[model samples]
Target: MLMKATVSGSDVKTGGIALHNLQKRYGNAIAVDDVSLSISPGEFISLLGPSGSGKTTSLMMIAGFETPDSGQILLDGKDITRLPPHRRELGVIFQNYALFPHMTVAENVAYPLRMRRMAKVEVEKRVGHILDQVHLGALASRYPHQMSGGQQQRVAIARALVFDPPVLLLDEPLGALDKKLREHLRNEIKTLHKEVGKTMIYVTHDQDEALSMSDRVAVMHEGRIRQVSAPKDIYRRPADLFVAGFVGEVNLVPVKLKSGTVHGPASENLPAPEWQEADRDATLCVRPEHLHLKTSPPGSSGGLQGRISGMTFVGDATIFQFRSETGLELLSKVLNVLPETMPGVGDPCVASWAANDATILTE
Candidate 1:
């Protein structure tokens, strides 16, 4: 039941963004190294990484707050590498709401329009329209100090959208809120994106946030992007060890390739990558959910023979820790549909998975 908000003049267009060999350095340390990416118009892309991984630095460069040592930033095919922040006409939302303490919600939402020398009537109209779009029309007279963190964030979003910029840049805008509020606001932001049809670039260290909201995710590590793809691809077919381990809960099993087969402490005669070199050491990455546990006799099933060492019951799933006969530890996650059918600790079990469910990492 949400209404689409419109701005005066035509809607913003051509929001595509391209980065070419972007690099930044501080002292002898490199922050962003040879980072290059292309974002399509109206696409929601998330720059995901841990702290000190240059995600924030990269966003800063795009926002014109920091200058890259070497690179070009093209917005809608126009180079804006050296353009000032204001001239770029990009909307930016920070971790903090950044609303004026003394100004009411209506006043804060009208700030950007007023800065552009917009007329009083037009500014008021735009502010009212945007406030309603964000479900804050009733709170127009509330000040920043009088609102909750989530409300303040919505005001920030409303202020940014009041001008209808072509691209929106969010730097962990929900990082200041609680877990439940963050989840709620992220969905709201996603809905807002669809309604506005503006290109959005969100930067965050939280994997769930990136996987849940982004149309595509660019995973950065050690000052460079390790992989860029859809959320499912990034989670299921990780490019490297860093990506597989960082994106989710994965069990790394060291294995050796002999001929066209793989040999490990708990598994043997496993399928090996066709492109991998023979007699090389590799690691098999498998998610806990992909591993199925059976109470079959050891060596009876073609999988790792292990004993259930421990189990932890989460809300919707139970995590079982398995200790292989070779002393290797592995984890299996199973849904908690029927507790009576669940295996107990100290039960002998075999953990197995299909070949396609595992990714072999050579590095």
Candidate 2:
């Protein structure tokens, strides 16, 4: 019987990574601006953004693939900004997997150790250890072409870890797989991180992946980091307009701030934002799930009159869009469990939420 390979929490090498005011430019375009980040030892951080948003460029610079125009990158307290890619001692996994086609899984995993000229016996020992660790011991002799995508991916990751590099950088490692496989691999990667305890930097445009796996997510846009925070905080308490709008679904309603409240576009009074100054134009940001929709306006302050416009059946829940009597559109998410209680489109309803659920973006 084959068993999954094991690694003790103490078995993996660990390192801290820091990027100090990193800047990179290509011709007149700035790929990464003066971005400084301090990542803790063994923490998993994701550089997340859309295309041309500088996340990938920052990762490449950390890996020594792209030279920065200015600033520095430190690994375990040493500057490696100018070091060549191979000399930086970093393990990298690309979207393509990058496994040599003709090589057996064992050969592919062992190639890094062999390159260092380790004794053949030691190389064999290390290869066997990692093959078991990744649960690929039985398929050691099989070539890349003979394995499923997930298996090939496992082989690629095993190759990266076999050499015991202190830092692991993954660029869209799960971009190619189907949803089910991607979800499985994500759990595997998270488990691997716990066992190995090495600093891991992952780059991806997938919000779900970043939010689900990372210890912290650095949201990047327009060559700058918009916000860096834990997954829940990034979604619930974004720092600015861009970050609030980018990370997830939020209903943006224009409002003008007063001494103690936000006057909505529909001339309704909503809760005052804790952070806004008096008399400023702002947008009231509230996520759909935070809004409660009812058939009639609530007995008191929580309710805001609205008419249901449309709804969408998102796999886990239904999202309903409502137009307030003042002509402002807002959204509410209702779970699918209650068929009788669920409101239909065009139904007259009231949208209500707690004052704390809203963030007023004055900028």
Candidate 2 lDDT score relative to the true structure: 0.85
- At residue 108, candidate 1 shows an lDDT of 95
Model 2 residue pairs with clashes: 266-326
* Candidate 2 lDDT for residue 155: 93
- Give residue 55's lDDT in candidate 2 (0 to 100): 92
Error of 1 at 154 (Å): 0.7
TM-score, structure 2 vs. true: 0.93
Q: For each candidate, what is the lDDT?
A: 0.88, 0.85
Model 2 agreement with the true structure over 1-363: per-residue lDDT tens digits: 111112222332247777777899999999988888877789999988899999999999999999999987878777889999999889999999999998999999999998999999999999999889889999999999999999999998999999999999999999999999999999899998998888899999989899999999989998888888899988987777888788888888788887776787765787645644677888888888998888874343445787889988888899889987777788888777467777888888878778888887767
lDDT of 1 by residue, 83-121 (tens): 999999999999987899999999999999999999999
